[model samples]
Target: MMDIVKNKTETSNSVWHVEHATLAEWQAVMAWAKDEGWDMGLGDANAFFEVDDQGFFIGYLGKEPVAAMSIVNYSSSFSFLGHYLVSPTYRGQGYGLKLCQSAFAHGGDRCMGLDGMPAQVDNYAKWGFAGGRNNLRMVGQVQQDYHCPDYIELVQAADIDDIVAYDKSCTGIDRSALLKHWFIGETRYGFICRTGQEVTGIVGVRQSQDGYRVGPLFANTPDLVEPLFVAALSAVPQGRQVTLDVPEKADPTLIKLAEKHGFESIFHTLRMYRGEPPKEQEHKVWCIASLELG
Candidate 1:
């Protein structure tokens, strides 16, 4: 669906090699992602590699990079597939399938999840992905007049451990590495709502190629969602484009809240699983991290 062969001119004959990409070589895939309108975060290259260094795979036609895919094994029971792409020069030659199989083989028998474009849903089904749910990418410059609750505070260094633990409790997946990358100064910002030392909720927003993206919005109770969301959006300058990837199965109130704040559905990705899906606390999550990494 990304039009892999959109403007390419390539020789008909070719051979491809698939292998893990080092942190430096991974930058090439990021470049291609930018070319394809992925809108990934600036520090994603380093942060994603930390999840599983050997998880990022690249397929090369001789010495030139042609395709890339990432299957990050966050835990032995869970792996997430993302960044699937093929160069414009190499479509119609089965190279994408080759790269996909290579990435999938790395997951072995673990449940693999991915958020894919609608055009590829059937192909993914044939490859064993099913149970698709739409994850809407909501965009808007939300305006909030309410003052931040005293319980809500900017994420501090000391809050990292609790935030990581809280995320695991809510999502049933340990993505501490990616969460850690959220407070890396300028690129990302985070806020946590606490009640007498108890973490009530947390949200993170990061700069992206397209706009500021708010994700992984989790709460202990539904009451905590709005404050955390308001706090995160407050970090972005007024009128800047902001995005939130909200799963179709999230709490109904969260959907209404997003809609009430002037946010509109720009597009959506289909969240599918290749095996047993994660048993996350859906009601507590307002948005997921980017589809490419979630």
Candidate 2:
């Protein structure tokens, strides 16, 4: 933790504090994200917090939080940076850069990754983050009658271990803690496609502010992808919109699936990483869990 006063003047004398955010403070960060037009899923904070209790940092000018960032060290050699924000009134005063410094320090020598808004891609690159794929945020109304394949089954608590193992195979990260919280919420829905007890595909969808979001859509083959997607989409209520973030360079079939379902690309983010990107089965990542988490 570090605290400093900028000047002797009354207004500038207020101390600027930088440290890990408490649970309540983390909720405040989520509120900031919502205000920024990010449609975060309900119960996201709890799962995110569990990943690394000390990973979220907030910068306070006196008693008011002015900036926030998260550097989730998923493993010794890899981490993700996200939820980076500075209050509108506090921008241009270097608070954002200070928060970034804290995130980088916490990340240490690990390869850091972030899904940066298009406008900030260059800024991230200037900080040694190289651009990778552009992720498209596709949105559409859920198709109530979409058909789920016969092999697909609803994911239950008993299947968590298998789901987590499947996720690790796709992402190469042990995000079991996140998966645990992510799959059990009242408004959440998850399903898996299996063959003779072997999980071949999985997808999870959760209610969001606007509608719902599908993610962590991992599949062993393209043939299984659409069914898993349809199963997740069918879980959403009729007439509600759904969103999915798909990596442009991953499975091309993902784009076709989105189009067939009448999904439109409403937003995009640049995937950037400092040092080499983590090795994962990118093709298996039909839809990312979340830009913030990934």
Candidate 3:
């Protein structure tokens, strides 16, 4: 059983000790997340924070994990900061401030991208993060006749290199390593769009509480997104719901596509950054892999 709380005699300021998360802590963290309605996928959390990472911290009040966060290093391109969470019981007790400061210290001088929740924008802005693009969480019931283009196919291990290469150039942040772990290690479906022998687009679909979700959906053009969406949705179990996140500035066609397919916006967020935001186009992002990792 996980320890629910711990108090130390060394500090009077309620100093929360933050450490790396263990595989077994999934139960404790996830239970708290479910209780808070996060729709998290704890099963995938292990692989998501693989051994190769430079930062993944869990805050403890005594012996209990009360807050957690990770900073993924990306060299000069920019590091991504995410997985920041404070347990419900310990929130508003200065634990979140410690967690955020620790996360920034871990990230160092690199720029960070985070989809700040609506309520937390002002709080994050106080930390030097400026609002960037909108990250909309959209959902819809699967349409029975959703037709996939013939060229898309199931991805193999060998295709990872190609996917990484495409992802590196398509997005400002180099997330090649995370892509490998997310696509292969998490047991999610990897669908690739091809034009002749050339790989043109890629998408990943994973299971969540609401049903299947398509995330990190990357393609060269807005036109390619329709086909990619079809391929991603095709992998979902019949009768289950399908959801996709959309970047606010994406092609107007995408909104029509979502509506035509019966999808609706569930919530939206501002992708904020401290210092300068990256130069890549948020308009092309069709899905956010997760709030924790994005």
Candidate 4:
């Protein structure tokens, strides 16, 4: 639990104090995301905290929490801003901007990126985030009857090194800590595609607030993606909906795979960056890890 200690910089006239969130406070932030209709993975907070404990932030009006945001520094050259929210009661008081500023200060000199809600794109633009690709969130029921490819196999602890390497190649970000927690958990399932001893693709599905979510789906080519996708959905319980976010400019066949599996576009966010976007292998990324973490 977080101790509610007053900072030395706090002044009597200040309406709110911004500080890094403790583990318990981070859980509160994830709960807020769920309440806002965001389908978050059950173990996201734990994995996220391990990535960068100082990344999460919360604002408080004395003892009451009012705002939250995250600025995860992937490396000296890159960072991602996300989990931004301001309590309804505190709107128009500049609390969100204060929190945003804190994040910016914490990520000095690094290129920052965010998945901004469509309605807030203009507001983010004012803060230097230039719009890039659109990320579409698609949802659909798992097709239990689909045949699983014989080449696809369940991920094991031994496969961690290869998986991490493949992920780094796809995203251009080192997230080994996050992947460790995300891949080895009771509520999650991970699958890999191989061409005889070499990993060619990988995907993971985890229990979410509403159902299941498949993400970080990466493959060397479109042909290797479908099998991994089908294998992931097959691990989920029958009749449960599975959601995934895909970059709009991804290979057209990737979208067709979603449609073939009965998925529909439910919502979207603008992928914006404050500096040069990371030189990622976008064509290999069939699905993103999560909007909150990215």
User: What are the TM-scores, per candidate, against the unseen true structure?
Assistant: 0.89, 0.92, 0.86, 0.92
lDDT of 4: 0.83
* Residue-wise C-alpha lDDT for candidate 4, range 1-103, written one tens digit per residue: 3433354236466556677888886877888888887889988888888878888888877777789999888778888889998877778877788777665
Instruction: In model 1, state the lDDT of residue 255.
Output: 75
TM-score of candidate 4 against the unseen true structure: 0.92
Tens digit of per-residue lDDT, candidate 2, span 1-294: 434223312246486667778677788888888898788888777788888877888888778889998998888888899998888888898888866765578889998889989988877988999966899999998655676667788889999999999899898788888898687778988898888898999999998867898997999999988889888877888889888899997358988888988999988998888988876898788889998988
Worst 10 residues of 3 by lDDT: 1-10
Q: Give the per-residue Cα lDDT of candidate 1 at 106.
A: 80
TM-score of 3: 0.86
Please give the RMSD to the true structure for each candidate, in Å.
4.8, 2.5, 3.7, 2.5
Candidate 2 ranges with C-alpha deviation above 4 Å: 1-13
Q: Which pairs, if any, clash in model 4?
A: none
Q: Put down candidate 1 lDDT per residue, 1-294, tens digits, no spaces.
A: 112222333445554567778888888988888788677776767778878988888887757888888999898888988988888887777888877766787888999999998988988999899977888888877465445567788888889999998888888888898778776577688888877887878888888777788887888787888888888777777667787888887366667788898888888899899888888887787788878878
Question: Cα lDDT of all candidates, in order?
Answer: 0.80, 0.84, 0.70, 0.83
Using TM-score, rank the candidates from best to worst. Answer: 4, 2, 1, 3
Q: Which ten residues in a row have the lowest lDDT in candidate 4?
A: 1-10
